[model samples]
Target: MTHWRKRYHFLVQITAFSLVLYSCDVTKPYANKQTVPDHLYGDAAADANANMAVLSWKEIFKDPLLQDLIAEGIENNLDLKTAAANLKAAEANFVQSKQAFLPSLSGNASAGAYHPSDAQASNTQVYQLYALSSWQADIWGKLRSTKRSMYASYLASEAYQQAVKTQLVANIAVTYYQLLAYDEQLNIVQQSLEVYSKDTETMKILKNSDVVTGAAVVQSAANYYAVKSTVPDIKNNIRQAENTMSLLLGRTPGPVKRDSLFNEQVYSELSTGLPVQLLANRPDVKQAELQLRSYFEQVNVAETSFYPALTITGQAGLYGTQLKNFFSAGAFLANIVGGLTQPIFNNGLNKQKLKIAQANYEASEYNYSKVLLTAGQEVSNALYQYQMVDEKAQSRQEQIANLEKAVHFTKELLKYTSDTNYTDVLTSEQSLLSARQSAITDKLQQLQAVVNLYAALGGGWK
Candidate 1:
């Protein structure tokens, strides 16, 4: 057969094979068949339109100081910076993956001398320069599947970066609030310590008048020192909390200035959107979904490998013994070759790889489902915590008010009647002190609950 006719027949055969491979999709098509629960918060209907996570950090965190802190954390936090670097690397890899279907060209130059085996022949010199290129036809969408997998992985990395940013903002806010709470607790202890000091002095005077025994004086002094000792501990907690905030800011250990806990305000009511919204709002959940897509694409890629790989390679260049004739047509050498490689006997390597790919895909499926469940659980836990804290706040306030009245009434009654003793005064003071401390803790826990709920709802990452 003539060369031209042979080339035409090869082209027709390649075209037909390409069409056949493209038409048959052996890999199972991926579908998101995950079953979302009826409602995330166990409600009959979902508030699909209402979404709290959509609100920016500035909107949810009312304090300007915390807002500034969050902004700083987003920019300066080392974890965020690392995540950004990973995202950039993933983006570059994805871009590189896109060039898989494109031909790769390489150049080479060589100069060598061939020695004659017989003594009568002279050594000959040869020089050659060549450009070589190769390309694999993505007849079965193998390159496309690999590219898609990399793209999904890149998206997952980006979503993971957002998740890191969200966590950083929450950490900074929580740490800053804890500092404020510790400061308030310290103030309470200080004020109570002074009052106890005065009571101890009164006890001494009563002991000198024989109105109270030695045990009362000792007990009053002990109570005063107990509150006094808490002062240093609370102050230490405040300093440690400040250090933690500084760490979140990616700065050296230092003080974090902020508003008082009482002044720190968050959104009154959280608007959690539909359960489906978590797939979009929560970065972790979104990342898991993307990971599942990436692994699925990998399975497709692995499956495609079971078929023959069609590659076309070519090289053309000049070669000559004499430098003068190197560029002439007589020195030119050119060839193009097309080949198909089938893994007829690979010792089960391909099958093992396919099995691994399928297993990884199944693992990703489990991860995506687990992440969805975990998201719902987190939101539910935070919601219940916020509700419980809010419910107790009122009762806690009432307890504080009644305790204050009891302390005042007991102290006043002690001076007016003999039946009221030093023990009664000590007990009232102890109860009042405990209630006051608890009030500060209650405020702190309530604030922490709000912070947690906001974070669980995928807030602060916007």
Candidate 2:
């Protein structure tokens, strides 16, 4: 009884010593105290409509081909795939972090044959089996704080994956629009070549009649050839565009079949939601915010490291000399132990780590603000560009109509007499061709502007 009392007293003293040495403050940083901008970009609270910025991607992009391509890119784009894998890895880390509060168990078994001098003892076999367990108790909330940090990191990784999805969708849509623009340009060039070829034949007749010198005919022929030369270049461009689109689709270079670019109509009216909503709608902004939260949690974890850790462990096992008797009740044995650990004079490593974590948290805060600012700028720029392009497209349409009428009048006057020189006909033809090309370009620009706005609004990844 005296020995047991002594042992109890010793255990009590050790427990008290450990408690005093390991006692530390585990208070978490005040979340509500961390103030962020109320509005991410422009004044959101002032504009109630900004809250309705979460429009679906389908409503934003009406092009069927564009929607299809975005879907394919999401499924097959390598960057998006890698981001998804990274998210999975982060989730695994979070799971492991949560397990830190749980006990770990291990078992060991050993058997050995020993031989002694004949005069001392005979040979014998000895067998031993045991189990060990360990656990780190979160008395100071260190493990829980670390687990929360990991959870935040996991959420951040998921946000990053969404950001990747958004980017892939935007890229695929832009590429698709680019291909359509190339098609429109090719069509315009082909029509110009046909008209130029007709002019070349007419110049030949004029030269034969001595109405024009060979120089005029040569000039007309040169113009025709010039227009014809553009055809091969346009075809080359088309092939390259196709190859690029194929690569974006995660496939080998191949022909991309599509309907006429002119037939594809894009929606003209668009709603430019207020910029502040970008914080919620833009994946990159959300990702940055999530990363900031993760950093804050990490700071909490680092601060908690200065506190004490409590652990309780237990193990049970059975052992016997014969294998068949290993499960016998008499061979059963069990033991349990509890402990507390405190860091003492660790050469300032923990202090340095806490400082690093605080610095990192500050960095993340700045990054979040930077991303928010960038998102606002993009939205503003896209809105301005879209509005400007729409006006330009309207003006180009009028210009094309007037140029077409001028071309027809010039051709009619040239057929009647020499009152209007062929030069006038050529000038009008050139003007009409230029106007048509400009109109097509304006249309392409309008489409590109819409793509830009959709991307800026984070409308691609639903």
Candidate 3:
């Protein structure tokens, strides 16, 4: 009795010691250490809460065909599917981590016979069946920290998937806009071809009548060929744009149906909200922060690995020489054990693990900060580009109008007066063509700018 009492007292003392260490072994809560600037959008923004990203992608794109393309890309883009697979994998790992808190049980049964070579030796047979269970107590919070890390990783994967979706939508819209621009440019080139062909014939008639020299006829023919040469290149551009949009939609390379560039309705209010909204709006930004969170939990896990672990194990079985007596009380056997294991030396492995985890945590901090800054840069750049293109629209239209008049005036002078020669008419006609094509390009830029701004503000993937 005295011996049993002493053993119980020793166990009580050990339990008390473990309880005292519990406070220090508790895992720390995660905190957001990243900072946001007062003005993330720079000087290009107006309202504090007018972000266009809050609107659905349909609201911004407005074209039925474009909305269909975005929906198709979101459903079929390979990269987004891959991200989704990764998210599922992370979720599985998180579930496994949670299961670690439960005990494990195993069962086994065996029958064996032993025979000796000597004549006097007799054969012996034994039969036994047993069940065993073991559980590790989370005395140092290591399991808890690991579970938290896996949870963070799962969230990061979800955010990464969203980021891919947002990017894919933007790419499809931009490529479609480029196709429309190419179509419009092709039309302008064909119109100029018609005008130049007429001028070429006019030059020949005037030369035969001696109103203008052969040089005028040669110049008109050269300009006609010059304008005709661009058709193939513009058609090639349209084909390439179509192929790109096809890939985005996960389809074979083919023509993409689209509306006219001039028909696109421009959203008057491109409201970029405050910079701080990026935390909630940008999936890539959220992904980076979640990665940082996972690494923080990993650091905690590493810290806890330096402490001791508590474990409990038990087993119960039936043992008897004869199979018929296996159910007897005398054949029953049972045992249990409880202990603690502390790592005293492991060739500096624990210290190395801690150092690596710390380094990873520090690196994630810098990466998270970099992602946040890049998000702000994208928003600012898109907003500025949209404004720049909008401002240029008026001037570009005026310039095209003036060049058309110049072409008309110069052609009339060449026909009725000697003040302007063939060279002046050719120059004015070339400028008019260039300006018309540039006007189409300007509209394309404006439309793409809005798409970019919407994406930069994390508009898609709702």
Give model 2's TM-score versus the native structure: 0.84
Expressed as tens digits, the lDDT of each residue in 219-317 for candidate 1 is 889988877878778878888888888888889998787888788674676777888888888899889999999999999988887898888787889
Scanning candidate 3 in windows of ten residues, the lowest lDDT window is 14-23
Which scores greater on TM-score, model 1 or model 3? 1
RMSD of each: 2.2, 4.0, 2.8
Ordered from best to worst TM-score, the candidate numbers read 1, 3, 2
Kindly provide the TM-score of model 3 when superposed on the true structure, using C-alpha atoms: 0.93
TM-score, prediction 1: 0.94
User: Whose TM-score is greatest here?
Assistant: 1
Error of 2 at 206 (Å): 1.9
List per-prediction Cα lDDT, in the order shown: 0.82, 0.72, 0.87
- Candidate 3 colliding pairs: none
| TM-score, one value per model | 0.94, 0.84, 0.93
- Model 1 has an lDDT value of 0.82
lDDT of 2 at 172: 71
Q: Which regions of candidate 1 are displaced past 4 Å?
A: 1-20, 119-121
